[model samples]
Target: MNVQSNPVTASDTNARVLSYAEAIREAMAIAMQADPTVILMGEDIGVYGGAFQVTLDLIDRFGPERVMDTPISELGGAGVAVGAALTGLKPIFEFQFSDFAMLAMEQIVNQAAKLRYMLGGEAAVPVVFRMPSGSGTGAAAQHSQSIEAWFGHVPGLKVLQPSTPEDAKGMLLAALADPDPVMIFEHKLLYKTKGHVPEGSYLTPIGKALVRRTGSDLTIVAGSIMLHRALEAAEKLATDGINVEVIDLRSIRPIDRDTILTSVRKTGKLLVVYEGVKAYGVGAEISAMVAESDAFDYLDAPILRLGAADAPVPYNPDLERASVPQVDTIEAAARRLVRREV
Candidate 1:
């Protein structure tokens, strides 16, 4: 297979609105067309067009050899992708649900993550693992977990969680270019969400955080679907005289500590909101980062994290909503923090 020596860059013209899933598919298609070395492998991604249909019609364009449909073994599929990456092919492996990654831990962590280091820079694994994560579809405890933090904790692996269609496309392209293993956690509920996406290939720099809204009263750090909720809460809080800054943490690993620290220092308060479980989640690490940094001195109040309850995601819609932080919950938490109540 042929590999494009030149990198794909952003285009200024021909921008159009597209859904999150469409943006992701567009990124993979662009990469495959540009570089024949890039291929896709996952369950039902061919005829079924993927569990969420992100890979729809890719097989028709790229053919079955490049757009392969593997059996129902995530471990086996992941292993194959890792091996392919090691052999100079860029493979995008999809996991229907992030929770299923538990079964592929040996391949992901032990093999894919450690191979480059074990080879002492002689080898590179250009594999991108896309996982549909989060707790919105009522798929129950098994399928609804937002487990990005689990992969983020590992070394030698870059973890990304894109919240918007623009970032979804940009980050995927960026991940395809990386030489090391990269894990992308795509929030399941954001699939149908629409936004303006650039027409051609673009790269959203990894390890950089985007400041969605700037404010002074408090800083709300959020990722994935929770970024949308935080923005909604920010709007409601604005009317209440609470000026809130919302930070969308696009990349989980190699987090933008400078952006987070600067925001917290300016606001004098930090509220980390996420859909992952409360204990030992991404929020905890962000809170610790600020608390351990110079930003801690600027805090007028204690750092607060609003995350999902310390329980499995419930299958019931109502129960699911309550288990995780909602718009109201985030707004109330920001209000309480500003008032020195919490």
Candidate 2:
């Protein structure tokens, strides 16, 4: 295996687009190529080539030692990754599905997340935990939960949910270099969806939100799959003379409160959208932030929230569609907030 051949340095020229999974693979390749100390560890990541093939061709390039496949114990695999990270080896751990991360919560949130802080900043756990999150594959409730809120609540962990291919690659690269624990929530539906990603290595700083669309009527704060829906809704609302600004909260933890507040103050109205259940979801936190910030006084209307219903992700496509905030739901929510119609 030639690790030096797959360097991940960014070029000064144009950036080429890539798929979400390909972007992830690119980050892994670059990281391993850039630093020999980086290794991959997870279940089915070796000969099986990963459950979603995100680690495809990596084992062939780095061999079994660097691209090791472990038993199907999330706890054990995660713990091993943490121990490796503590010893100066950058271990990228893959959780087959976000739902399975629950089984290793103690290791992830308690151990990996707290190691540096507990050690008085003497020890750092530079591990990137990647998991396929969100619903769309009919994976049922057990396999289709958006658990970003759970980890975002933890103090020592950084939670990232990139909505585009560019960010998928950029964020992963940045997370790999972070000195603390980082959890990346990769949307399952976006794996095959193609987009233009930078051709070489780059980093999108964590904790900064991006304004996807600019407008003055209302502001929509969203993340993950819901970001796409918010953009679609903004376009439809534009025709009705409503100018809506869509903000993508790419970094859930250490969220960009300044950017969010600035947008809401200009728009005078706010609508927070997320894919998780309405109660205590990302939207709730965003809405509260706006209300507490100076942006609250500039609101022309109450800060509205639209989110998934508090129920299991249904197996039926129609039922599932209705359970979450789809484009139509987002459109309606935007229109209502803009006073377009009911």
Candidate 3:
């Protein structure tokens, strides 16, 4: 019954549930209304309503001038957005797919990430790159990939992967307000997932993680859709006398090391799960963070990571389902970690 999301305001007592995509669009609409400098640039976003239809009809309200669509050039579009941000306009650039962002690495990793520091804070690139990520929709390898780990490695770039609709909206608004460039990877399957979202503007802290569920036996860390799966697994494992703690790692780059360390210290067992490739993913980073910290002394068992198999996203539904950790797999991993260690 536990949903992983930040608490809403007192004024949001009557907050309504919105699909993750709708919440994102609402955030952009709010930002655009409040700040004339806010603009959106992406291919097929205007008339076509974006590749996933997340930007549907924004052009009708903001008009083509503000919600202008770009050509199928990720590098060129990203360059323009970065350039726009340099000149003081807030541009939210949406990549058609997370995979396409690699084509603009020079702009994202080299230019946008370093300009503020390289210019000695003389310029701020308040650009938000919205990427529809993950591989649940049968888009296959080319269109489906969870490569947040790639840019998460890039310094000076803030990377966020929100699991809930509330976070999806709040985090986007927060990124728009930040001076540094932020990348938000929206899992494709989460677009239709709904959750309560507060009316009006708000911000979810970028670098913090939320302890979704508390337990004393084990800690399961996950983000994006994986967070939801972790929560489900935790609930099921509770019936088997294996209580598992779950942490929603909202931000990938600036991980909430303190929360993770504290949980591992309490639980003494860690299971890191992600939708990315199993080897050298964010799970490894968390494992290393715990292993290198004082939390290592508290661990009753060796830390384990559960992520996608070492292969491209499969197009077949059943194979795709097997490619990544699911509720059953997560439950099994948690049970194994707890029973074997605790």
Per-residue lDDT over 160-214 for candidate 2, one digit per residue giving the tens place of the 0 to 100 score: 9988777888899899889888999999888877766767678988998888788
TM-score of 2: 0.94
Clashes of each: 0, 3, 0
Error of 3 at 170 (Å): 0.3
List candidate 2 segments past 4 Å from native.
1-13, 340-342
lDDT of model 3 at position 122:
89
Leading candidate by TM-score: 3
lDDT of 1 by residue, 263-290 (tens): 9989999999998888999999999999
Best by lDDT: 3
lDDT tens digits, residues 1-342, model 3? 225354422227678989999999999999999999999999899989998899998999999999989989999999999999999799999999989998999999999999989998888899999999998788888988999998889888999998988889999999998989999999999998888888999998899898878899999999999999998888888887788888899999788999999999999999999999999899989999998999999998889999999999999999999999999999888887877743
Model 3, runs deviating above 4 Å: 1-11
lDDT of each: 0.90, 0.86, 0.91
Model 3 error, position 74 (Å): 0.6
Which stretches of candidate 1 lie above 4 Å from their native place?
A: 1-14
Query: Which has the better lDDT: candidate 1, or candidate 3?
Result: 3
